[model samples]
Target: MARKLTPAERLATAEKDLLLEEIADQSSWDQFLVEQAVFHFGQRHDEWSCNDLRDVLPELGHGFLGAAINSLRGAGIIAHTGRTVPSTQASTHGHRIGVWRITGKGRAIAAQRRIARARGRAA
Candidate 1:
């Protein structure tokens, strides 16, 4: 037999569902962080090594970082330079690392997002 929920219980259940939805959206938030990182690199006009990004965003797991960067590359948001730098991590045994640069499209997207963010903050 199913029990009926009181009004207060229904409200609590709705809030719980909302919280769960927010939690599920965290992946999107992390993706946004990855985009922001690439945008920052583009704005600086500097090629960013994977290790560099990892260092800057230590809170993001290595797997997530790799996947995020891969997603960006696949989406044409970032391109890899031929130049390789030594990995900052101790685990690398003389293996070179690829450097990433944001593409023109990425730059334009970043700029637009920056302006939007500024406007949002002002509002």
Candidate 2:
């Protein structure tokens, strides 16, 4: 008689199948990276300042990071606490000293992307 698989074995097999499905669903790398960044920032949502984000992604030069931040804000993925400050170069500085906090939608998207990546790895 054939023996049935153990509970652990069955779970592992199911997990592997689920992972494959997730990998197949991912569209591109940019989507993956954005999801990752959002997720990373979401973890420390309360402490994430624009400077903190820049530090986390040092490769994203200031201009690029600024654009990304704007994009996130526009997409409603992040929001500011509504505080502002004047800079040394008040004439040229229009940006505020805002702290970024990820929205619930952002967190959910990030979590979905992470799950997809994890599933891909399992596959």
Candidate 3:
């Protein structure tokens, strides 16, 4: 007789399927980077700097965060609010900063990621 699959095994299979689906649906690397920036920014809807995103998403190449931010802006996934110097840079950079926040579309993408993660966990 065939053995029944364990709950953990089932979950792993489900997660793998979901990951494959995501990979197939995702666009190019630049697009993924832009989406990631939007999703992360959505978590902190408040304005964030390029460095902030870079720190959180190390997978992104150096200066790639800025490119992602620009791409997101073009896609209307994020918008610039203004800039402020963080405490760390207030002295050296003289408070030179650029602020950005996610848009409605960005929120939608973030919601999708949450749903995907939930589905993965449920499986």
Q: How many pairs collide in each candidate, listed in order?
A: 0, 1, 1
Report every candidate's CA lDDT.
Answer: 0.63, 0.53, 0.57
lDDT string, candidate 1, 1-123, tens digits: 446433223222312223545645554556545654655665686688877777777576555677667767776777898888988777777588888898876766666666766766798
**Shift of residue 49 alpha carbon in model 2, Å:** 1.8
**TM value for model 3:** 0.54
Candidate 1: segments with Cα more than 4 A from true spot:
1-23, 26-32, 121-123
TM-score for each model: 0.66, 0.53, 0.54
Cα error, candidate 3, residue 43 (Å): 1.7
Q: Order the candidates by lDDT, highest first — what do you get?
A: 1, 3, 2
**For model 1, what is the C-alpha lDDT against the true structure?**
0.63
For model 2, the local distance difference test gives: 0.53
Q: What TM-score number comes out for model 1?
A: 0.66
| Most TM-score-accurate candidate | 1
